[model samples]
Target: MPVRFGRIAARMFLPKKHNPRLAVLLMIVATAFIAATTLFAKALGGDTLGPPLHPFQISHGRFVFAFIAIASAVAATRPQLTRPHWGLHFARTFFGWGGVTLMFASVAFIPLADATAIVFLNPVFGMILAIPLLGEKVGRIRWSAAAIALTGALLLLRPTPESFQIASLLALAAAMIMGVEIIFIKKLSGREAPIQVLLINNFLGVLIASVAVLAVWQMPTAAQWAVLIALGICMALAQACFVNAMARADASFVAPFSYGTLIFATLYDIAFFAQIPDWITLTGAGIILSGGLLLAWREARLRQLP
Candidate 1:
């Protein structure tokens, strides 16, 4: 049993052919890493160092460091920073920065799993936004899938008559902005390098967040500094893995598997915060995953029909 399990684990982790199975596995692992990192960030945010920076501040710092690290690495490897299209670069800058800011803000108020789940709605919003933004056709299947996914989101939110937390809305807005970011990235494909886009997005995020960090800048304790650095490194690695996985396969094939983050987030929440999601949250998550799978299948079928 041990040997068999080892072999299975090796197959899941090892880099090999870029088949659909491998792509799905990579995406799942990437999502798990991201979810775990989110929990780690939350834990670190509770630290008393640096005057208790908001999640947005921590996220901003992470991106600033990430930009420097990625830029240095790109310069060391590629030695070129020229972009073919400035408009696409600018679009990525705006969308990516705004999305990250809003996502971080939501994290400050919501549970790890809830925040992650809400952000996963990006694909659902992507389909809706694509019709108007990219002049793409949204067929009946896509429309239905979007509606089901949105319904799942509403169930998870379960807005009360008197309860109002703008953070929830911020998360939804971030997801929508992320959908737009993904569309723009698709537009930039073949015209710009992935590393270039990452650099531009991070650079802009840092510039935008610098003001906040300045206003709220407090010296972090040794432990807080360590966790901050670690979070930045994990984020960079996750982004690298995600980029490699996407490059190896079709987005439609890999995106659904990214939902595996929910599993990791739930585990981390349970282990770290002693939090267990209720049945409603679990049911809503299931519906969201189902909708995503349906959309992926539809896309795959459409790809094959041609």
Candidate 2:
């Protein structure tokens, strides 16, 4: 039974051939699950308790549950926990932990749709960051697309003197850090197993979130438990899909589909929180998605050229 389970689990996380279509499909599914996780984070932050739960504590619960949930798969499937590339794994953990922390913190106070839209800025950053960090070249069209995408994010943020929001800045920072994180993941993806990649990040998140939560920890209610469970299971499965998607397709191709997260997130926001996006928000999101798609198409064409 154990062997069979292990094989089944291992098969799910293992990388497959380059299939842009399959990668897009997996990314679509991942976006939905990730949107739900964001909603749960919002719920936890604004629960009935006199003081809302700390974002760090919520982050802790998220990874702790995810780590526990993935344990069965790891025990049954992976031959080893630690890999040869310890340095890369630790670096990934550092960047991933920072990104996740900021992401959760953003959702706790911002509208889900707004937060989701801004995080899609990673592709723009990824394209630009690649030149320096990964020593990759970017053509003029991609550069134009990056500029358009940045403009779109600014449109979505639309900071006003009277209505400035720190959450928006946090989301942008999360996207920037995650852009670097994605590049690092690409560096390691071909060399490391996807499951172990996820495990390393989640384990580190559990450790970091645990220590940070100690300053503002509170007991979880039953409802909060359900939210955390959903966060854990959904994020674990979502991360698997995302990692595999990137491994199988160009990051640009896989990236634009992430804007689909905005759609799902907006729906979740409306359905759960009764928050509807104003015309400006919808307009900005549309521009953002267009820019992201443009970047993806340009990157894909570049890859096909040589």
Candidate 3:
């Protein structure tokens, strides 16, 4: 019986075969799960906490939950907490937390689909930042794709007096910060374990957000508490899946799959809020999708070259 139990445990815990396709699929599922969480957050609203919560307040709850979940997971996994590159970790944490806060704020103002679409510019920004920060070279193909993606973003924003919202600017700021986070992650990729990076950033995020929440603390209703807990678990799981997927495949291969989140977000919006995007939003989304796919293809092709 002892031997049989040992064999069973080994089978369960041992690493499985590497499969890039499976990694891509997991990334898509994780993105969809994240999108669903946003829908849930929107539905729960500020009323989940007895009083109507502001958008930032709901975001604070979500971050608190994420912190608890991630901390627990780190304890269970016993990952190496020591980071050789503390500076990169700190940079990533500051930028990542800011981006997350801004994103949550935008979610409160804009539809989930639109908000997600705007933030999707992260990859484009990543590509641009990589050139200067990482000393990476960008070819003509990438530049063209970046231009096209920017145009799509402009279409979504419209920039006209009727369409302007300072909230959209917040989204853009978040995207830029997210780009900084990505660049820092790339810098730290091989130097530290992914779990370490995740844990540190989440820990810092919780700490920073906690200070903010304290200043604007409000009691949460039982239902809001449940929603926050659920969101935290989902966010941690999605992050884990994303890390695992990236470990298994190239970023260029996995990045395009992240776009699946937009589709899921749109469905979530329609189902929960009965919100259908107008033609302009739809057009912009389509263009962004096209540019993202093209960029991914270009990256994959370049990776295969010698």
Highest lDDT against the true fold, candidate = 2
The global Cα lDDT (0 to 1) of model 3 is: 0.74
Tens-place lDDT digits, model 1, residues 1-306: 333332332232223466776666667778876886677567656644444567666777678766666665565455355645767767876787678767767766667777777788888787777788889887899878877877777877768866445677877888899988888877887775666666677777777667657776777778777777666656665666677678668877787677888899888888978789878678777777778778787877777875
RMSD vs true structure, all candidates: 6.1, 3.0, 4.5
Q: Could you tell me how far off, in angstroms, the CA of residue 138 lies in candidate 1 after the best superposition?
A: 0.6
Runs in model 1 lying further than 4 Å from the true structure:
1-22, 47-51, 79-82, 161-166
Count of clashing residue pairs in every prediction: 0, 0, 2
**TM-score of every prediction relative to native:** 0.84, 0.87, 0.87
> Residue 219 deviation, candidate 3, in Å?
1.5
Per-residue alpha-carbon lDDT of candidate 3 for residues 1-306, written as tens digits (9 for 90 to 100) = 323332332232224456799789879988987886676566555343466555556566666666666666555555555636767777887788788778777766678877788888887899999998889899998988888877887888778898876777777788888988889877887886666666677777777667777766778778777777777667766776777777677777787888899999999888877889888779888887887788889988987889
Q: Model 3: residues >4 Å from true position, as ranges?
A: 1-15, 44-50, 54-56, 80-82
- Ordered by lDDT, highest first, the candidates read 2, 3, 1
Clashing pairs in 1: none
Better of 1 and 3 by TM-score: 3
lDDT per prediction? 0.71, 0.79, 0.74
Candidate 2 ranges beyond 4 A from true positions: 1-11, 14-25, 49-51, 79-82, 243-255
